[model samples]
Target: MATLFVITLIATAIGSISGLVSGGYDGLFLGASTGLVAGVAAWAVALMVAQWRRERRLNRYFSQDGPVAQHVRQNQRS
Candidate 1:
């Protein structure tokens, strides 16, 4: 997504600048690599958390005590 791409770019820029300031060419590569990995991990975690929350909400909505279930029960008696 756009959010993930933006996060990755920001992280890479930060890492590259820091490495350039502290060390040299080698440090730049190392910092960029580390930043990329961190960005992807963060994105993955965000996706998982979103999915979990969605599933939880759906489960609650469809449960026996939920509105849908109540409506179904009402129709059954008619």
Candidate 2:
């Protein structure tokens, strides 16, 4: 959230400054780098693992498919 925004800002500033000082568009290019993509890849891996765990648990307990599994509990009972 806020941390990500700050990180992106820092990347953009550093890239821009270094690029302007030495090369050109290096700032913008670096700013848009895929370095953060590695982090995203890790997060994706973790999320996939968590999803698998959840699916295993659901299969064991519910023995049900989707839609039904996603069936949220009723909050307002008649």
- The number of the candidate with the highest lDDT is 1
State in Å the error of residue 73, model 2.
22
Where does the lowest 10-residue lDDT sum fall in candidate 2?
69-78
Model 1 bad stretches (over 4 Å): none
lDDT of 1 by residue, 4-28 (tens): 8799888888888788777799889
TM-score of each: 0.89, 0.41
Candidate-wise lDDT, in order: 0.88, 0.58
lDDT of 2 by residue, 1-78 (tens): 455555655655665665566656665566445434544555566668979998988777664454444453332332
The runs of at least 3 residues in candidate 2 whose Cα sits more than 4 Å from the true structure, single-residue gaps closed, are 1-32, 64-78
The TM-score measured for candidate 2 stands at 0.41
